[model samples]
Target: MRGPEARPRFGLSLRLLALTLVFVLLAEALVFLPAIGRARVVYLEQRLAEAHLALLALEATEDGMVDGDLQRRLLGHAGAVAMTAYQSGFFRLRLGPDMPPRVDAAYDLREVGLWPPVGDALMVLTRSQPRLIRVAGISPKDPRVAVEVTLPEAPLRRDLMRFARRLLGLSLIVSLIAGAVVYFSLARLLLKPLSRLVAAMRRFEAAPEDPGRLHTPSTARHEVGEAERTLARMQARVREGLIEHARLAGVGAAVARINHDLKGILTTARLESDRLEAQTRDRDPDLARTTEGIAQALDRAVALCAATLSYAGSELPSARPRRLAAHHELTLAAQRLHQAHPEIAVNLDCAVDTTLSADPDLLARSLDNLTHNAAQAGARHLTLAAHTSNHQTTLTIADDGPGLPQRARDNLFQPFAGSARNGGTGLGLPIARELTQAMNGHLNLHQTTPSGTTFHLTLPT
Candidate 1:
């Protein structure tokens, strides 16, 4: 949908950009979740290592004991309220408060696996107040000894929160940068070309007949490029269709103007033919029969004239089949053609005669139209060849007149578009073909070239 009625909801470009950000942030979250958990474990391991070092400091002191002030200093340096190391289930070194203050929680670091629990880390981060936590693990300096530390979770949580802020800021920056890069890259590579196609459709919809509005094929070798090429072809056809439609519309208006007059003329001819037939009926049977055929042809003509306004709309009326002498009808058509244009010579190839079951009036009208078309095309000599086989009769109307042109041959059977000459309505062959089909038969151009043109008309016999 185009024009000024519907507003744009959102550009695909912006949606892609937003999706990129969301995806990037999700990727960062994937990294951030496990990383925060591991960060907690690393912090605990550092405290254990410091506790071991502090034990070494105590061993270096006189009597393997340190005063309260020095002990507190060592413990504070390790970021622990109390520190102890046990070898073979016995304490090797101990420092700080006698019992620490009833541990709030205890963790065996050795069984904590490769990384600290994410749930535990989250819990520390969410806790409102600091509480003591006991951590026990193999001492970093001596794996054979177990080290335990009493530490305040507040410090660990503070470090974790600080790390989160820094990481979150970094992730945002990276997401924005990556998102923008991806957005613009896709916009240039795909979105812009897709937009071009959409825009071409809208533009074409606005003015289909404007050749300038047709989509130009881009050299891109992708599916979109193929679409561009296909769109060009489609627009070309649409332009042709519009042109044909306009021609038909003009033809319709002309027909509407003349329909009444043409019907009046046909009716007058039918009445006159009837009167003539009545006058000659007893005197000359053949003349009366010929006059009857003329009146019947006029009746068919009036019906055809009524439908002329349809332009491609209505179906031809039903065929009223009758047994007729095929050879005689061909001769009659040939005589009519020769009389209309004495400059052309007409030959009949009526070696065998056969009875044909067809609407006599329709058959004559079709034959008349084909022969007249050949004559009008500047033919010098015409041949009406007839034969019967397999209960069907074939009439080949061959003309030696510069054949049909290539342009005419291409659209030969199409109404209003196959004429080679100027001011031609191009309905002759189409009307003939349609009449032939109405009789459950066929009319086809058998062959055409610079040498001559031949049309094959087949009917049931």
Candidate 2:
């Protein structure tokens, strides 16, 4: 047995066909009702006209009468068993035998309403046995006089049934032709394009990384066409993202290998720097200072290598939470910032002596990244301020820099794409944010304008 998706069933074509057929039949039925009624009326009127003409012939005779044989012939020609003519409020002529046993129904041809003829016609059609009906109308030749006739309902019913059958057959033919035309037209215009889109989506889903599997959208300027265009654009973006991910994966592998070898080299250089420092401490102070600078640079290099390795391995260094005085951490970061960029002025203002619960090293590293970024942006004056509010310690770092560019601000904190300065890897801010988050702290760029830029760092106190 086939599943629901695999089962074959009626589609839009069949549905449209059935709908068209039903609508056409309904329309024909509406026309048939009034048409049958009108047919019955016309039949009675024709019989009355024949009877009137026969009466005229009888009146033309000298005695205003006809032989029995001639009378029978006239009534047979009019298709009525009996007929009477009245002129000037007097009976002028009478034909055929006496009145029938009973009249099943009576109709006034001069009746004004729409439903009377229809009702009479329905009575005729529904009668179980042949009926004798009486029809009265003004004579066509003489408007002042009236003619009456009695006719069997069987003939009229037969004619109406024949007409109905022909109409039904014609309606079926027209519906079939119309449904075919509509089905093919819509199938080509709508269903075919939709089917193509579905097939394309399935193929793309099966192999999303394959750029060639993406759909080529239709150029039609319709709603369906717009959907196709949107899907195409989305598929393009997805493909680009996949390609970028693959490239990043490769770069990560290369960085991991470099970090492994470079760590050993930095360790050796650190040992040599320490040995040189010990030897020169008793001799030249300038040489000792230079060795100390070399040792500091080596330490920074090793830290950066470790950070890169950690990021590449998708493992952020876990934070060891501790309580530390906010003022002390701020002063230390400020002193380091000044040492790194001595030409830049530093101002530290701590109005709150708050102890913050966070990883001290991680907090200091985030502050260092923010200050170093400010210095690199040609900032001349850097201000570090701290305050405690609602059991939270907020640190504000403002700088008199040219401010970040719009592109950098948009992609800020996104690794490899957010670098503001040339020849700089865009990893600093993202790593800072990662470290801040691990310490349960928040870091954000508060504002950036032509005059300056500011950063906000918040930690629990």
Candidate 3:
């Protein structure tokens, strides 16, 4: 649903829902966990303390334990049965076996003072029915005879469950209220801006030319500001690109119409040059050679005009790849360049004396553009060279000129985008590069220095 001139689209509702879920989950966990811990701790502590007091109440006699009433009271308090078992001179009282399964045996025994204090927390075997005895003195009246009391755990379980439910309910309510408050606060502060951005996007979708603005609230230098700026820049660039594309399509159509008239003009020039050649019969070889060169130059000019027309109209030019003389093409390009700019000197170096299987006319045109670029860049001298290595042929054009600026170098082959140079149409490099590539060759900027720049073209041998 994205288009040019659209504003920043923000997903505030999704973000709010996500944040609400997270906060609700966190609050629920927090209350649920601590409440459970506190309930367990309070139950265990009370049970243990009561067990210690119960053991103290029983008195031991010579015959057996006394004060049965105290033992029953201790059992009731402990929610568990107390047992007495005698062995030798000592009498022991241990906590009852078989507690409720819901009650943790570990927590229950830990609450009672009967549990031992050692390296590890003493675990009372509530399940293992053990017998314990309360020892008495060597007298019948002594309240030290062993006695048993069964502790009921049902009351403790009921109380604990009720307390747990109440705590759970309270915690749930608090969690929901807190989550709602957090969600609303976030919605007002953060989501409001996003909602506005979304509304702006909707307006833009309705009418692209007059898209709504996405003004960011200056609250914090967070991701929100960065996102706003990025969206704005992207929208502006896309809008400009669409407009530029429309203009180019129109220009392409207009150029197609003009190309026909321009071709006719070049054809007239060709006929005139041919007539001049037919009339000229010089006795001097130098004059003949000069006339021949002029004739050849005019032919090249016509060829270039045709190529330019093809380029403007986006027409693909035909290629005739064959074993052609490299020196001839180089000479023709250099001579044509010289005619164009007599001030600049041209030099040729043929390191590899071989013919290349490529379109000579296209290659020459590529070289012509490179030379013109160098001249335009203020080059005093130009050198054209050819080399062969590993079954590949390479042609290099070097210029003793002020090198291309960084901006131009980065996008050297992009059309209609000039670097720092004034009055540059920025199509020469692109056209040259396109022609070279169409001929199954590659073009690249070999190197650039303060003294000059060099362009390299490669074709398969």
Candidate No. with top TM-score: 1
- What TM-score do all the candidates reach, one by one? 0.63, 0.53, 0.53
Number of clashes recorded per candidate: 0, 0, 26
Evaluated with lDDT, which candidate comes out highest?
1
Show where candidate 2 strays beyond 4 Å: 1-8, 87-90, 99-101, 112-123, 140-144, 221-227, 241-461
- The sequence of per-residue lDDT tens digits that candidate 1 reaches over residues 51-137 is 999988978877878999898889889999888899999978888877567889999887885445777888888888869999999
User: 1 or 3, which is superior by lDDT?
Assistant: 1
Model 2, 105-207: lDDT tens per residue?
7777887367677777777778768888888998777798899988777888887778767866787787778778877887888878888887788788778
- The per-model lDDT (C-alpha) reads 0.87, 0.84, 0.64
Error of 3 at 130 (Å): 17
Q: What would you estimate as the lDDT of candidate 2?
A: 0.84
Q: How many backbone overlaps does candidate 1 show? A: 0
Residue 268 local lDDT, model 2: 98
- TM-score head-to-head 1 vs 3, winner: 1
- The 10-residue segment of model 3 with minimum total lDDT is 117-126
